[model samples]
Target: MARMRWSTSHTRPYTLRQRRRGRERIQALEQQVAELRAQLATQWVQAQPTPGTRLDTLLTLCSALLVTHDLPAILQLVVQQAKALFVGASGVLLFLSDTTGQMLELRATSAGTLPPMRVYPGQSTAGRAFLAPRAMLMAGPELALALDEQQPAQYAELSNLLTHWPPVSALLAPLRLESQRLGSLVIYGGSRAQPFVPRDLPFVQALADMVAIAIVDVEERNRTTQLASQLTQTQTNYAEIQARLDTAQAQLLQSAKLAAVGELAASVAHEINNPLYAARNSLYVVEQDLAADAPERAFIAVAQAELGRIARIITRMRDFYRPTRTELEPTCLNEVLRATIELVHTHLRHGHVTIQHELDAQLPQIVAHADQLRQVFLNLMLNACDAMPTGGVLTIRSTNEPGDASAASIVAIQISDTGSGIDPEHLPHIFEPFYTTKAQGTGLGLAISAHIINQHGGCIAVASTLGQGSTFTIHLPFTPPPTVVLSMYSTLS
Candidate 1:
């Protein structure tokens, strides 16, 4: 009995230990089973279609839409893809007309015998879809009933148009980008067995959203291109207008300066005339009193000549402000040019300047004051000679510019010199009186030349490059009108 009792105690402990180990093994097996169950559940969920798959599809559709730029192509692609998403389905896309916002026009269709239809807002099924905020799914009977109740004429028209390929059900979604309601997209099912379900609404709506995005993007890009073109044109016009304004302002300022200088010159000439006359008379008397053979008599003669020259200069100054009417006659400009050149031939020779003439042989005669024209030519020639201090070619050209319907014939004379050119900063003021770059200049040569040309109803212009050369161009009409001559004489007198 003792040995049996001892054996029972030991067997009981071993059995208890075995039970604990078996229980632990069962618990471990249960844990493994739970883990396996969790893994299977995850795999099953992964295998099924989820929102992420839809998102990836939407992203792919968006990428496709973004690469396309044409509006019609984009709409056609959308409808075709939507139709492809469901079997036995036809798709149509409608958009608001750009010209008339009140009407929605059929833009693209995948498969249908429907005519090109224009629908008014709040009138048809597509219109209602466009006005709605979210997507809608309607059975074919319900759609027809609503169409008949809302618009009988439209329902009859649609029935006639769709008799060949009638719709059994439809999924509609509004094309909207933010607050802008662009249009609507509709997918029509032909078989009742393959009717679009509620789950199809989100996908159709996504396509509609893509259409809206594509349309808005294309339109915005077009508008941006137009605005950029307009901006460039506006800038060009502004620059041209500003340049004209600057020219006008400079002309006005020049006129003001000339008027002020004329008044001052008249006053100074009046003040100096009396003293100059007295000195000339006294010198003449001294010359008459001295003996002809006396050395002092030669000095008196020179004094009289100097006084006479000063008087002539003073007279020219007076004529500048208050010119007398010099009689006009038929004058040959070519002849006048020859005479003036002869007078300055010595000076030009001493300056080592070579003169080249390109006179027009058939040049016609114009009515002008020969002496005044000669003086202008002389001044210009002398100035040209002075420009070429070291020696350069002086080219004189004369051409007769024929008249057009708007302009009369004129004579154009160009005098060009290969000499140091005028500085750009000094070119604008060169014609103003008392403006000169030479130390010994009287500063009245160009100013008087401009005035003389103005009185003759002509114009003079100069073009110079700082390092290249200079050209002075004079344009004279074939004849000044009688009224212009008379007006000029009257104003100057």
Candidate 2:
């Protein structure tokens, strides 16, 4: 067997990159401190500060300005310190919106007259250090004049706008707040001096952090404003929906009252019709008797007729109050459809309206509460008739509905009218108790009918389009009509 060779894993040794970077950064910070120590050392003897330097000064000052949510103010202070110390040049601050992000936004500027109007981060030696976030100092070829003159067109323009006097050398560094990387700052040489040194990274990093904190503050302000706007919009939508619901409820209530009155009137009129006919015939007979010179007979006839009118009125009162008993039978859906049409025939006298029928001849027998179904169908037909006040097509249809493996079958009675359709806004509340569009209409007829059909295990659905027309289809199951059961024991001989 061949001998197998195996290798042991060894941890990789630390590289010189991190070590060298640390040493250079510390050296840079010392140089920056040495430059600032002369002036800052005197500031320890606290003097009467300006209003902006009072207690809670930065917070109060930042809150007063809406600039970048005041993030720039914080960036400004960081760069100001660098300017105070490194009296050699002007500086800039830039921030990254997030770590590992592409965006680099210019946040602050230092005291100086810039070279010209130019795109930021021009292809200069200082621009390179800013992009790399590393320290750099140039004293030789890096300060070549011909190179600076042929700058990126955009940057050259921005440089011209920035200053009447350009710095000879500059320093660039990044700003970060906690995990978020805000941006960076660039400081250029004030007089004809060499560019920043590699030893400047430490001081630059510290200043970067202060700028980052200000960026955090500004972002917080922006978020607060957005949240407030969303809340206001939400509240407005809630109010509008609530108003529509309330209006719909009120309309339904008024509709119920009209239906009740209509039902009562129909019953009274039926009862009175009979007695009125008898009285009219009696009057004709009395007139004939008076013409034959029998005036006394005519007077007796008139009195009897007067008494008959009173009896008719009382009978109507009794019928109106009595509960109607419905007969359950095997009723043909088409017959019910025809009866409903006939009931509303007298109401639909407009010559412009056309009646259409498409009754399926093979419809199954519908075992239903006949009288109640009649009343339900009648109400629907009348509603459809009323919709077409100026005369339109009233279509009545009936068909057998397919059933499952159950005891009985189902049928559908559909009434469609080409009349003014319901307003779309009222569609949801149309079936609600007492909702109606008619002026003299009590919205209750449909509501009561809906309830009765529901109790009988059926449903009514409506489909309407404004200006087109409306259709109401009632679904009746083939369940046997329920019968009242009474428990009574009797003895029979």
Candidate 3:
């Protein structure tokens, strides 16, 4: 075995002095190490987040980011905070360009004093991190040692650039979501100490996630609020229309009741007069044919005829009061309309209202009460006659709708009076009950007409412009009236 030689043999005379210096150096180093440990402890404590609150915060931040339209502002703030948090070398935030053909663009950088600002295409190491999006660490002998052995010139170049600002051994974390690279967050550790170690990878990753979620959440909230406001506005409009409808319906009811009364009055007059006239004629005939001594037939015949008239009057009265018993059958609208016109012929003749019928042959038969429908026509014809005090064209037309098969088979009777137009504002409420524009009119005729027609599954509408005359259109539902679903509320116009 070779004898071991100690180098201290030459310095023996100075041993005590060296020992004293060595002890002092040890004490100083120990103190410094203790101070450093305290600093590390503080940093560790600060790093701790609220208990189990990370996920909740991430969720809230994500929601906020979705509503933010200005991603650039969010990115700026993030980068600024990152600089302080990392306390590492200078950082660069690189963003992707919109154009697919172009390379990545560095939107901002902390290296404010570098060569006049320039954009870097997807080519350099920073670009590689952006493209690959993975955290990278190279320190100790591995870095310089690799640089020394691999490519000294390139290593020196990279070293110089990094030293310019961050001034350190470094760690680079790719800023990205999934595989899509938005940018990169580069941290600087001064030459004396690296900013991060392998232990800190999780924190870097967590920070990156928070930034991504925050950006997405802000944008979404803004969009949701805008949509909600638009929906609210739409609902408001619908509500206004509903209010108008409520008022219109009340008017319809009043008009319908008046019209029914008017028809009843007219029917009663006709019924009563017919009997009175027939009985008088029967008496005259009996007087001329029977002998005074042999038969005395005038008194008997006149009395019998009067009784018949009384019976007829009572029947008509019953019909007028018991309107609910109107017979429902498949009635052709054309027949009912013709009958109504004939019944009101004298009235129209008196008013000088010319009747025009343009009944479409295509309309199918409707299921309705014939007499009720006849009354509806009578009311309309009479109104038209009244409108044209000096004679005007009253056109009635019927047509079938091609679509709406269930209701398509339609009969439209339009009673247009060239006398005078109604106000536009009143047109929409014409179907409402108790509303009338005529004098000496109960206002119920039109409303009742609308109600009766609607009960038969039809609709009545009026269109008029002041000074342009008015046209009342009746569209009878092609389908038979379904069994009325009885309830506390009555179905009316």
Candidate 4:
């Protein structure tokens, strides 16, 4: 009410003072905001890992690879480390099928909820990761849009986990090296606060690469160890075989030496026999010419008696080297074996060799040279006696092989000895000329016997084992006897 004179200039001075205070307050508030922003920037720098620390973590993951060769163990480790690096994410390591590139196997997982499952390369989040060369991120409707409805279950399982966890985003990185697509590393965002970002893709991809390298190294090492074991076994077998061969060669040389000595003895006996026969005849004539009471006649008679004894001994030696008849006849093989055994019975008893005959009485007659066949058995018997210098059994077996009407009838004769068995190496050459195992063998006996049997359409085979025994098997075909020739003079008479 004191309408006294209102001074506009005084009011202007108060208004200007208020405006100046307001500007000072605004400046102070702006300075405080700038300081807060700087503090936030520093905090962000501190929170993020340094390149060196991140590299060390990656190296630590790589070092873990050396500890195991198992594939599942390696992949589990990879997923665990990936979840730690990518904060608030559940991840899986998938392995691609070598045969079908479309097949994706979820080998390992960071979270334990997902059972081991298989998915297709074009059908699910893991599949798309495998198909793509670089890292990719999907969020919201993109996950559903990219999924193949035809493979609903595989993609659906992924959807269900996502819905339950309700991740804000999902990321995928390929486990690839050059052209080889090993598999994919898949991660789903676990929370909105720590969602998967574009910056995280490179680190996930780097981790995938390290895992692929470890897989290749483990497989190569397993293959190398297997090959080395196989090579060592092969070498051991080869050495054992070589040792046996050397033993056989030494036996062969011993057999050859005995045959040479026997040949020399036979030749010397043949040269001495003729002269000794002439000397015995002269002594016999001198005994007849002298008087009965003469002293010289008595000396000549004694000389003739000694000479006759020498002749009988030489005849026995000649009989063994004599040639045999070549005529064939239908004869019983068993009878021929018995006769040959009789001839050598005295010598066998002297050498302490026992003969055991296992004759097949039902055996059919075979067309053979009786004299020659007998000689063959006799030679075998003598050889058996020589083999058993310390005494053993000589087993002889004869059997008729059963056959169809159209097939040829066969006879199998086996001569076995429980003597110092022929060396396996020497057994093969037993029928070769001048090859023998005996100290006094002529070596022509088995060779000549084998020839005769072969001429009669037969085969002979021998089997022996060192320190065990030997068996000589003879197989002969049944053949009819030859026609006998008659003289015209006999017919006229």
Candidate 5:
């Protein structure tokens, strides 16, 4: 009995020791399970992007769309952000080509440099996604089948492009805004620790929407800019056309006025000439009849001189209507100018005016009427003297212009006076017949000068500044036009 009791006591203590060890093992196992649960939670949280992070990514893309206009730059930004959004994934952006809407061109990629690639609708993954209504997650056999259906040439090109970073799986989202389908955004998964799944579609689709909006905005802006430029050019053209019409109307009016004045002057001069000659002859006879020492002799002489002056005035009026028949010759312009200056030197000096000559030494002689040119020069110089009554400088300049493709070589003469400039309102009418600013002026000088220049197939222009000075420029060709010369001869004959 004593032996049985000792065995029972020893076995019970050993059983208690084993039970304690088993309880300790259960506690250790519980701790291991808790640690495993914590690790799983951490992995799950890391696998999915946080709501705040996704929103920030979308906002950043929206900001890029608003500010940036360059298509490639925006595409690159989209692909980069897409790659960052999907862990262990590369990205590609494809768009319909501007030249061919049927083909999709690879624009940007996160996978470094690749050869140019194009895909046809319904023939490749990107193209199919463009036609699809929603995003697609393709993998394994589906991706291979899509590639195998492509034309051999396209397959080779796409294969070459994909070799840089071959995709194990692909997530595609069509870039669409309402009814408009632009292209596709593709996220390619290689040998990634976390593979793409169906849940990733919404994020990629949102990004694709951003890309579409950006493209549409940029294209619309470019179109608006081009239209504005065209509008401005059209307005400028309209203004130029209007100005040309105004100038043509003014020239037509002037030509009509001159024709009417010429007819009237010719009639009046013809009527006066016969009576003028009779009066002059009668006065001369009376002067001859008077005795040399007679008191009436001096008065008779004065009457003869006054009748002669009247005849001269009538002759000038006739000449203005029908220019004197003068043949065009190779006239030395310098000689004509020098003689005219000599005749007007005392007149200009009396008005306290100084004359300056800036003649070209190598000036070529032109075909012109020397006498008519002398008349024009004398008239212009006298007018300049009249303008500068209180002393000023009169500058006469002559230059020989070289020929060009559009125009022949020509001679340019400028007569400038530092005097009270012409009133802007009067400048347009200064060359009109019987128009005069001076109180006692005959007003035929400038009109005759302009007519003679026009008959020679040349042009005269005047520029003046208020309170400054005036310059009169004459442009004469080296040779007069055959038509103009023939017309002049016909008129004289």
Candidate 6:
């Protein structure tokens, strides 16, 4: 025998072969273990909450969404429900962006102490998901490493959130509505929290979808509220316009009645003039023929006086029925107003009424028929005196006022009286022919005044308080109608 000394070399082959076999077995065992681990992970993912269960929870959340009209409350509830679903998540953060997507904003977060943070689409996990509009996840050291890789200057503010609550894992999903990503939702799991598996992603995504729907619902509701308010305002404005139109139509009808009355008065005045002249001549002859000492002379003188009064009344009727002349010229309204005041001074004195002038020194001249304007002012002053009866103050003011876009400017004339104001029920009819409240009034003064103002391309408005006083405002544009100017020029030529 070669003895034990030869044994080291002689058994080396067997030892090497045995060692190689053992190493092969070990590698095969490791491969089987990795395959088994993969299979187990797949089964664990499949073992997550059933579709029916997810559907039930989703339905419950949707019911809550339907009743909850508040947007912030809905978002809070969504995050809270996501925390509950994961069972061990530390908190959730919601990042929303405007329609333009220029800037991302931190909207809501379930974690009380988590500092707010925002990132652009190319930066962090939240941003990446927003770009892809897909779900993403990171666990433990991997999340920390990714965050650290970001530039120190740009991500300095973001470091505090990670330092304060270093999550063991995080899951994120984009909140999308029909291919448009509105924002992203992030769920953070603490060190002791359960890992959020793949199956849980669907549930999280569903929550995100619910959030999208809620956002749209709230926006649409707000829009509807605004539209309703606008519609109500429009309806109110339409009612006001309709009321004004009705008033204008009534005025037009009254004007037609006045026109007819004027025609009748003109015909009647023509018929009465001849008879009045013959009667006046007969009275004069009778008075002349009577004896100087005869008692019949006094009777004849009284008859002549009565005839003269009748003739004066006929002359007034003729003036009232005369057609208005269309000739207009630029005339100073103050001069016309003063002339009118002088004519009515006697009547004002009898009524104990005082006149006050507030004429604007810089008041520009306006295109007008001076004679017609003077007549209009005379009628207004006489009417004011009648209204006072016991006496009061009359104020006349003039000023320049801005006009509409198409007009250059306007001259505003205001006549105010401190007297017993017209009754509200009677005010509207005051400008109608024969609608006077006075016992001896013909009721044609205001109607004729209104007609004259209208012919001048002006508008008149009256405001009265039953016991307080009354004010009549006249707005007249500075320029006259082209036809009036042309006709005047033609007549002059």
Candidate 1 lDDT by residue in tens digits, 1-493: 1111123355345678777776777777788889999998887656444666666766777888889888877777777677666554644545554455587777776643435667776556787787888999878668766455435554555555442246777787888899887888767776664566788788878778878889999999889989999999999999999999988887877777677667877788788889988988988787777777989977877888878767665655566766645567788899988888888888988999998889899888887767667777888888888888998888888888889999999998888888888999989888887789999996778888887777778998999987667898888888877765784455442
Best by TM-score: 5
lDDT, model 6, position 120: 78
TM-score of every candidate relative to the true structure: 0.74, 0.39, 0.48, 0.50, 0.76, 0.53
Local accuracy of candidate 2 as per-residue lDDT tens digits, 331-419: 78788778777767767766466788899999877666565677688788788878888899989898887877774567888889998
User: What's the distance in Å from true for residue 165, model 3?
Assistant: 13
Better of 3 and 4 by lDDT: 4
The clash tally of candidate 4 reads 0
Q: lDDT order of candidates, best first?
A: 5, 1, 6, 4, 3, 2
Model 6 misplaced regions, further than 4 Å: 1-57, 112-117, 139-164, 248-260, 292-431, 434-493
Query: What TM value does model 2 have?
Result: 0.39
Q: What is the lDDT of candidate 2?
A: 0.59
**Positional deviation of residue 403's Cα in model 3 after best superposition, in angstroms:** 5.4
Candidates arranged by TM-score, highest first: 5, 1, 6, 4, 3, 2
Model 2 segments more than 4 A misplaced:
1-207, 214-331, 342-352, 365-367, 400-411, 423-439, 465-467, 477-493
- What C-alpha root-mean-square deviation, in Å, does candidate 6 show against the real structure? 12.9
Mind giving the per-residue lDDT tens digits that candidate 4 earns over 1-493?
1122334566445578766766776776787788888998887666656667667888899888878788878888887787777666754545555556768787777754555468777656777888888888888778656554325565556555442354567788777778988788788786765567777777877888888788777768887888888888888888888877766665565445435534554676678778887898777777778788988987777788777756643433332333223345688999999988888888988888888999999999987767667767887787777777788999999999977988778999998888778876787678876777668776777876776576567888888776667788888888732221111011322
Off by over 4 Å in 1: 1-60, 97-102, 111-116, 149-164, 275-324, 402-407, 423-429, 432-435, 439-444, 465-468, 481-483, 491-493
Poorest 10 consecutive residues of model 5 by lDDT? 1-10
Clashes of each: 0, 44, 41, 0, 0, 0
Scored by lDDT, the top model is: 5
Candidate 6 at residue 352, lDDT?
Answer: 95
Question: Comparing 1 and 5 by lDDT, which wins?
Answer: 5
**lDDT (C-alpha, whole model) for all candidates:** 0.76, 0.59, 0.60, 0.72, 0.79, 0.75
Which tens-of-lDDT digit does each residue in 1-493 have in candidate 6?
1111123455446678767776777777788889899998887666555678778888999999999989888887887777766755777778787768865666776744334566776556567656755677777677777556555653554444332356677788888889777888878777452576677777888888888888888889989998999999999999999989988898788867777777777788779988888988887887787788989888777878888757654544454544333456789998888878887888898889999989887888998878667767888778777778899998999898876878678898888888889999998788888889999998887877786677677888899987778998988878766754453334322
